[model samples]
Target chain A: MRVTVNGDPRDVPADCTVATVVAEAGVAPDERGVAVAVDGDVVPRSRWAATPLNPEARVEVLRATAGG
Target chain B: MLDPRPDDLVIAGVPLTSRLLLGSGGFTRLDRFERALEASGSELVTVALRRVEQAPGGLYDAIERGGARVLPNTAGCYTAREAVQTARLAREAFGTDWLKLEVIGDRRTLLPDAVELLRAAEELVADGFVVLPYTTDDAVLARRLEDVGCAAVMPLGSPIGSGLGLRNPHAIALLRDAVSVPVILDAGIGTASDAALAMELGCDAVLCATAISRAREPERMATAVRLAVEAGRLARGAGRIPRLDHAQASTSDAGIPDLTPAP
Candidate 1:
């Protein structure tokens, strides 16, 4: 399956989970501030590994950054 | 989740210690962010949620050390859907439902898109988020935001980072009376006096970023803004004198002889 991870296009094997996309985007397993959202729906941290991804899915791995 | 002291800033039942909600933007380094937070004595700080491209160990560490509650903002989102998505991500990343919702209308103006903002606010509020929308200085729209069960309404004094200060003090005052929720001046603050003016105009609090972060002396400027906020709050409580075309003399006619020696 082809998915966009944090705006980066990536080709991962079929049946990829949200955790696979998140970890591939440089987020550590122990990273505290990271969050994943697939197709605009927030994937809870506990469900990342269990959740499956669809073809051409857009996964956003977000975290807190400095802002006004 | 610190309980607010008596007479403190309470929004959506969350009591905040300080009225000056500082923004963690425009700093080149992490130390300055920490120092500015310290100098301002601000108990609340705003941050944005973006793609996690790299490990943000330093930023989180500074925030932890600063001991200020984080208020995640949708600074760059332009649409209701986008802002809502960003808010969801922010809640998960920051672990706070308190959101500074910004739906930018025009890039050059950096003004809030009223239509989009209200739509997003309604959705977010329904989702159990404590919505604090960054809005325009109009009482009419502020009322709508309040009607949607927003925790607070943040009306911008001017464009984001414009440093123009409160462009319309009368409208801001009107907004303060219009909304029961807290009124926080969100942007366009140039210096300490600007922040003071915000409070004097009846704002419940002020959220400033470039004014303090981009100053020549960020830390000192932060302290100045803090003091100005306090002074303005006190002055606002003190009734102001009515304006008149002519000046009034402080001394009585009987004291005129004191200066008559020159004749």
Candidate 2:
């Protein structure tokens, strides 16, 4: 299946979960201070394992960065 | 000797002793950022959300270690939808509902789109986020933000990172008077005096980043900003004398000695 991760187009397994896409986007499973959203709706950490990604889904993996 | 403790700045029901809010950006190193954070005495610090191509390492951890509350900002978002989504993601990531909303209208000036900003502010407020919008120095917009349940109205003194200082003190003063919510003077602060002037104009607080983080001596500049905020707050409470068109004599004619030449 094709999905847009952090605005970048990529291919992933058809049955991939939110957690799988998160890890595929370079976010370690033990990484702290990261959040994921699918099509603009936040996916809580507890639900990442069960939330399945739809084809052409937009996944945004955001983390804290130094800013003013 | 005015006391700011009696009038603590309360944002979204969180009472804070220090009215100076710092931005955790532009620091060359973590240690320097920590030093500046300590010296500034700010209770809230702003951070941004971005893609994690590379790990942030200890950056966010360092900010947490400083003991100030984290305020995530949507700095790069240009549209209302993007800003709203960013705020939601920030809330989930940071575990805080506080957001510094910034919806840029243009790239060159990095100015907020007033129409989009208002739309985002309204939406975020309805979603239960404590929105503190970075807006222009306009009284009407400040009122509108307050009306929409924003926790505070942060008006810029000038363009972001321009270091222009408060270009329109009167306009800021008007904003201060027009809104009941806390008036935080955000952006375009270059030095200690600029921060002081903001407080002197009756602003509830002052927020800055480049002024301290990009300084030659960030820690020293941080301390300067701390003192300036306190002094300005006290000055405002102390009630300054009204300006006059003509000078007034300090000495009395009756007390003057008759040593002048005879007329």
Candidate 3:
């Protein structure tokens, strides 16, 4: 399936879950600071495993950063 | 209400002893950031959310180690919808609903879009977030933000990172008087005096980032800002002497001794 991860178009498995996409996006499984949003809706950490991404989904994997 | 123990900076029912909030940006290194954070004595600090690829790692852990409440900001988001999405991501990233809402209308000035800001505030408040928006010095807009259920109104001193100090003290003062919530002087603070001036103008607190993090010595600057905040708060309560157009001597004319050289 084709998906947009962090604004970059990529090819991933058809059955990719939120957790899998997040992991593939360079966020280690032990990293708790990362969060995901697919198609503008946040996928809570608890449901990362259950939630599946659709083709052409806009997936955003973000983490806390420094700013004023 | 921040002099005695009972007096604290209470926002959204969370009491903070330190009113000087710091932003985790522009530090040279992690140790310097930690030292500055320790010196700042900021109970609540601001952080930004960015894509994992673009963001530097370990800021969250550093802030956590210092025990400051994480206030995630929508800094780069220009529209209401984008800000709302960023806010949601921030909530999950930081595990805190306290948001420093910034919907910028311009790139150079970095001023908040009052229309979009109000819209976002209404939505976030309804979504159970304690929204503290970074707004202009306009009192009417501040009131509108308050009306939209924002926990507090943070009026800018000047533009973000401008370090220009309070551009319109009157507007800031007017906004302070116009709103019932805490008035935090956010941005464009060049030094301790600016922070002091902000507090003297009746601001509940001051938010400084570049002034501290970019200083030659970040830790010392933090301490300086901390002292400035305290002094400003004290001076505000102490009641400053009225400004006089003419000068007045501390000593009486009658007490003046005789004679200069025989004029």
Candidate 1 TM-score over all chains jointly: 0.93
lDDT of 3 by residue, A38-58 (tens): 998989999999998899999
Q: Rate the local accuracy (lDDT) of all candidates.
A: 0.88, 0.91, 0.91
Residue range B20-79, candidate 1, lDDT tens digits: 999987876788889999999998888877777743645755777888888889988899
Count clashing residue pairs in model 3: 0
Pairs of residues at least 3 apart in sequence or in different chains that clash in candidate 3: none
Stretch of 10 with least lDDT, candidate 1 chain A: A26-35
Q: lDDT of model 3 at residue B100?
A: 96
The reply for model 1, stretches above 4 Å from the true place, is B1-4, B54-57, B255-263
Q: Count the backbone clashes (under 3 Å) in each candidate.
A: 0, 0, 0
Candidate 1: interface RMSD equals 1.9
Candidate 2 lDDT by residue in tens digits, B149-237: 99999999999999999999999999999999999999999999999999999999999899999999999999999999999999999
Scanning candidate 1 chain B in windows of ten residues, the lowest lDDT window is B254-263
Q: Which ranges in model 2 have alpha carbons more than 4 Å from their true place? A: B1-5, B261-263
TM-score of each model's B chain? 0.94, 0.95, 0.94
Candidate 3 residue lDDT tens string, B45-164: 888888988887888888889988788999999999999999998888778889999999999899999999999999999999999999999999999999989999999999999899
Better of 1 and 3 by TM-score: 3
